[model samples]
Target: MSKFIIITGGVVSSLGKGISGASIGKLLQLNGLKVNMIKCDPYINVDPGTMSPYQHGEVFVTTDGAEADLDLGHYERFLDVNMTRANTNTAGSIYQTVIDKERRGEYLGATVQVIPHITNEIKRRFTAFENEVDVSIIEIGGTVGDIESLPFLEAARQLRLEKGPKNVICVHVTLVPYIAVAQELKTKPTQHSVNKLREVGIEPSMLICRTEKPLSLHLREKISLFCSVPTQAVIECADAKSIYHVPENFYKQKVDEQIIDLLGLTPKQKVDPKWFEFFDKAMTPSKSVKIAVAGKYSELQDAYKSISEALRHAGMNNDAKVEIVFVNTEKDNVEEKLKTADGILIPGGFGGRGVDGKIATIKYAREHKIPFLGICLGMQCTVIEAARNLCGLHDANSTEFDPTTKDPVVDLTPQQKNVVYKGGTMRLGNYTADLEEGSLARKLYGKDQIVERHRHRYEFNPAYVKQLRDTGLKVSGWHEGVLPEIVERTDHPYFIAVQFHPEFGSRPLRPHPLFDGLIKAGLKRKENK
Candidate 1:
């Protein structure tokens, strides 16, 4: 039988519920339980695929091709597990499912309402992989009292009844802000937050209080009295120097012991201390490297969450601290900002917001022999840059930027030519590409074949492949019909670009080969300097 863990936030937003949930997931996985994670969002949109990066951060694509919330990335990296579309659920998806069932007369002519109809669909996401795993950690997005998450909360409340109290664990994460002037940590907000959740018919089994400083036993006791939890159940989660150390932090509090006790589980094995080792190595590095990331949405770090985390993973593998400098091509001086960069990266993005700046950055990196990496649109920019500058095709441009360009160096594929939808309509999920022997990509991945995630519409024009290759540009990796997946400059040191997003596959313990190689190249540049 599978047990369920419900995680919800209270008092405020951006309270790090995602990290808390991920830490718990890791603890259970380390304790020899087969663990899974699910994210329940309270938005009306089908997914975050169509939403702007500024609005919802980057959309995480599962191996199964489901575009999910960014928190799923945390779960995957923490547990070292690949999530699927089944691990995600949203209000829009739940309602849409119910409506579709009603339209098909599956409801048997009964008047549909939010109670069992919508809540049942929500619960379906919880029990999705029940038989496959020992436990599933379900995180409900939005605040406690928000109208958007009511149906999710209601469904979670009823899960206890259906699964029996022993099969379910309700964990509520709440804020415990400290007032410098008052010289005390406030517990009122947490108490009121618990009260609000209690009104929804779910009493949190544990309180993971987010605090800046360590919570004294007196403070924990106060929260326990007010929140109706045991003093030991009030887990004081102080801010950590790094998010990776969170699992270790909770392990010290015996959080895993409490969880297994509540759910009545036998230990599959002793909890591994590898997370502590991982945290130790991350905190102490032998050297450092600076990598410049050029993109339009550079202002918000969350916009490129996976890319940054992937860089950190690479940094850990190389025993070097990776300093990420975001060069916003839209407003910053492209050349001036990248003058001191050891490496330059052009991440994925849509529209023509900063094409000229990105082109300039690529030209500078190529001419200066700096290690450079381009992805998706970035790879297209490489084609455009090589076409115009190397091949002297001044009119070279992507159709996405110039619809009537004389030389369409980048354009839509045949299958996407007449596509109408914007959301979830791109060439997404996993695609395979065979690497050329002795090529940079082949050497880095240590294999001829590789699979990576993609989320873009425009593709490098195959017609321009010969022209660019003739100009010393290498087509290192290719998909079907000789379509390019990875490209590089033979003349430069460690310059590689790909049409796929390798960051999605990168992990902390085992970094993706491309990213790890990028950091290694950056380190070499630092040494040569």
Candidate 2:
């Protein structure tokens, strides 16, 4: 049987419960324990697929085409593990499954209730991968007192009881706010948070406190006294310059030791603290580069969390510091706004609101000899802009917005089969793309064939390939035998657009090649400036 670590949050939201869970999973992996992470979201959406980026940050896609909560992205980047659709479950999805079964007459004339039917589905999803891995780190979305999250919390509570105390453990992440005037770390918030958890019959075996300042011995003892956890297990998670430092920091706090003791499992391997030394060096490195992200969702920091982390990883690899300038390309005066940036980056997105603005940003990058990197929708827009301005194809547009176009520069893949509808139908997750030899992408990746995560449906139409190439646009990457997946401006300085989201696979320790190349271009641009 697999040991389970259930991570819950209380007091309020945005307490880094997901990060704490991911940190624990990473520590377990360092101990040579095969680990898998799962997230239970309380939202009513079947998944985050149809949700807006403004609402839920980025929708993380899995290998099996599961559009999961953004925390799954954190799980994948932290542990360097490939998760499947089975790893993410939401209340909407669970209830939907149960309702579908009932409609099919599978439940057999019984009045369905949330307790036995809904909670059963939740348990089934949780244990679906029980025998597949050594440890499963499950994170409950939302706070302890949320009305929507009550069913998930109840289901997890029952699972812990059924799985036995030795097999299951709960870690509650709470905030420890520091009052600048008082010059002390407050502990009442944690006490109330733990009291809330206990009221639900789920006493946390450990408390991970997130705070700006380090927890004092007095504060730790106070929390332990009220929360009912040992002082040693009341781990302090101070804000670090980089998230990668979390694993080493938590390990130093004896978090892994506590987990081992609680689960009654033999320690598999010793964690090497030296692995994070390189990351530390990267964080405090001497060299620095500025990369401008011309994205639609720049107002919210979480909007580009994966993309920012990916760039940080690349900077770490190059032993440089990446300074991100969040440029809102949707602004009216975008040209003046992006004038001083070292390099231009257009990330993935949906909808048609800021598309013309994104295309304008792409045109500016191409015309001004700036190094440009485009992802997903950014790639399609680059092709559309290039076709219209450079190739003189005035009618250039994506089928996503103008599906009835007579001369579509971007259109849905005709050869793509088994795609049902718009909600989850896009070619998602990990897909292989063949790069042309002697091209910029091939040289940067150092490989002819590469696989990356994709989250878009519209692609560059091959019908305009000859026209685009004749006008200085190179179709450098393709899928199967036909569809154009990457387009590079032949006449410009390092302008490239890729259909896949390389940010999803990037880690602090392992940077993606595309981001590495973009950072290098940014550094070169800074020197030129």
Candidate 3:
């Protein structure tokens, strides 16, 4: 008897449908209701695991090791819920499941059609996690007219019929374009988008319109009239300075009220507007810090969206404005770039495209006494750079790039008996890391034991630990097992790197410890400067 809300988009894609769905879920949770989120992607890839950052942006890893769409990351950060592999599904996954069942003879020799077979698989994934929570917010990827997304839309439509209209609600997010030359907001696109959605079997219970300007009353009425929704249900999502302001903005638009009324739910707790006050206070800037991020994917901003957000969250926590300067380590003159920033960051990536540049940046940071933070591959590079430059290990290198090194600073797992290929099958997702007492990590976390999400194939070779530490690098944190997880420089002002991606778990309210610590170190550097 759980309620459901399926969110769809039209007129175009990337209209913040995922964020809108997440905001609704957050609002529902704030009203004392247990909510869960699911994502349905139209892509043929089994998952986003094997996709390149340039193609699909970053592949977000869940607590249960699912490499999901980046929208799931937004859902987890907003709702504070740990998503799993079961919560995400794609066209490829659905087809794969059907084919696997056919191969296993579970279909009973019947010829499968798209209607019952494909839609059934999609429906099964949707309802699989339904009973686990009081409400499930399902966001369908792609626009309404996308042929690849038709099966998902059909499945969701049938689910509404099976679950009864009272138990299901459809929320459609569309865009409202404003013409600067004419100086008027147009509603024809939204009307056409609604018409396209109605061409299918589903009618939107609420229309969330993305607009640059405030939605005037006439436009709202026109959209409601053509879209067959109430004027009040036409929620305008005007642009906000920070995405953290979305919940309060939606609340002001009476989005929660419309949802509650549509679902026939009575509130158990009154909605509080004070959370926005807290968020606003946190975002109020008292100072500024500039941090340079050196990485292979510096050309693409979406490649490091989560990391950028984490830095912003740290700034919010400290009531400061963080100015991130993207430094393409692949470019020449890397040292000149490092000299201008307060701190240095090396993010995670695969392959050896710009690794030499990263090593050069790490060398500059270490030699100039700049605060440095590295993650995953960055951590390994830092170790290799330290071994080569500081410890006088001339042949230091990562086994990932140089498999035949006599003194490999970073290497593959000695425990694994076979050569491992990359993609989805890395040491991905959440794992526990025990911090050494009196270390900077422990001080920042305020706890000795912590768990963070990881997405990397290479690990820090523990055999080089003693030698690296003897040369002034401190293995400040490690997994309780034999493998090394985190390493820090004991003598530097603030230099640490981990084999995990803390950016995945960071939120607007709760910033990751490493990012917060890095920003603090940056502020200190700025003060000294």
The lDDT of each candidate is 0.91, 0.85, 0.87
Worst 10 residues of 1 by lDDT: 474-483
| Higher-scoring candidate on TM-score, 2 or 3 | 3
Ranked candidates (TM-score, high to low): 1, 3, 2
> Candidate 1's residue-wise lDDT over 1-529, tens digit each?
9999999999998888889999998999889989999999999999999999988998899987888999999999999999899988889988999999999999998999998899988888889998899998999999999999999999999888898999997999999999999988999999999999999999899999999988999999999988889998999888888899889989999999999999999889998797788777779898999999999988998989999999999999989998999999889999898988889889999889988889999999999988998988889999999999999999999999999999998999888998998877988899899999999998999998988888888888888888899998979999874678999988998889999989899889899888888888899998998
**Residue 253 local lDDT, model 2:** 88
Per-residue accuracy of model 3 over 175-265 as CA lDDT, tens digit each: 9999999999999999998888888889999999999999989989988888899999999998888777898899888888788878887
Who wins the lDDT comparison?
1
Candidate 1: pairs in clash: none
User: Per-residue lDDT for 378 in model 3?
Assistant: 88
**How would you encode candidate 2's per-residue C-alpha lDDT over 1-529 as one tens digit per residue?**
9998889998778888888999899888888888998899998998989888878987888888899888888898888888899889998999999999999999899999989899889988888779988888889999989889988888888998899999988999998998999988888988998988888889899999999998889988988888889999999999887777888899888898889888987767887776677766776776788777877788877878888888888888877888888877666567887787777889998777688888999888888888889998888888889788988778779877777776788887764534666677788788888999889999888999888888887788888889889878888888886778788876876899999888888877778988999888878888877
Candidate 1 at 495: error in angstroms? 0.7
Per-model TM values vs. the true structure: 0.99, 0.96, 0.96
Q: Of the candidates numbered 1 and 3, which has the greater lDDT value?
A: 1
Clashes of each: 0, 0, 0
Q: Which ranking of candidates, highest lDDT first?
A: 1, 3, 2
Pairs clashing in candidate 2? none
> Which of the numbered candidates is closest to the native, going by highest TM-score?
1
